[model samples]
Target: YRELLLRQRINEAAQAVMVAYAMGGDLDQLAANYNVKRLTVTPADNDAVPPVAAVMESDEALRLRVPAAFEGLSVAGPTAAYEFH
Candidate 1:
């Protein structure tokens, strides 16, 4: 059961990554959450592979074709309500 739970958690994290890939230009919040890290993005800018969240939010055409899950995980910026990112 513990293994199953871990698998589920891993899958959830993967889904989150997919979501981030959708949004365009790699917003800081989405990338951090999906990767389970505090802002460790590579390239400093969009390169061959952009951040998951960045791909989805982007209206502009992306070089790579991201998935629909990207549309779902639109992790908001630091909430003004709680002042948390």
Candidate 2:
């Protein structure tokens, strides 16, 4: 997938999370849709474009770059919910 397309997907995911959060959905439920785990440090990698965070990459490799800009998040939103760790 193209980098622009992947970023779009990541943005979509982030938006969904916000929606779910607004609806008071538990983190697990939202995470489930996003492949997030419980209590574990899940990579917020949103820089998933073209062979980076691809659905085909090995799990370990994807997890390693979770903290990246595209993966983690570079921009702040109107109601930005993410915080630096």
Candidate 3:
């Protein structure tokens, strides 16, 4: 039991260092390091009889965007610069 608990703790710690494999809130935190924020795909509307659910950008999409953001920093106007913005 003690060994299993230690392994679980080690796995949790590894998530912070392994941003590429991170998901959900962990991914969000990692993206913030690159000054990227998750975008909302669908807005929530509570005024309607049935409230609409809000859909956010997926972790996979955000992961791709985060790296692309760095390309925007360059002035050379690479292909990624166009996509980044």
Q: Return the clash pairs for model 3, or none.
A: none
Per-candidate Cα lDDT values, in order, are 0.40, 0.43, 0.87
lDDT measured at residue 31 in model 3 versus the true structure, 0 to 100: 85
Candidate structures ordered by lDDT, highest first:
3, 2, 1
- Report the C-alpha lDDT of model 1 over 27-67, residue by residue, as the tens digit: 33444443322323333444537444432323222212133
lDDT of 2 by residue, 1-85 (tens): 6999999888766765552222224333544454543333444457655323323333343333333323334355422224322
Clashing pairs in 2: 44-71, 45-71, 46-70, 46-71, 47-70, 47-71
TM-score list, all predictions: 0.26, 0.23, 0.86
- For model 3, residues 1-85, the per-residue Cα lDDT tens digits are 9999999999987986566888898889888888899999988888977888889999889888988878988899898898899
| Each candidate: RMSD | 14.0, 16.3, 1.4
Give model 2 RMSD, 1 decimal. Answer: 16.3
Candidate 3 Cα misplacement greater than 4 A, ranges: none
Top TM-score model: 3
> Which stretches in model 1 have alpha-carbon errors above 4 Å?
20-28, 31-85
Off by over 4 Å in 2: 20-85
Worst 10 residues of 2 by lDDT: 19-28
Tell me model 2's lDDT, rounded to 2 decimals: 0.43
| Model 3 lDDT at residue 77 | 84
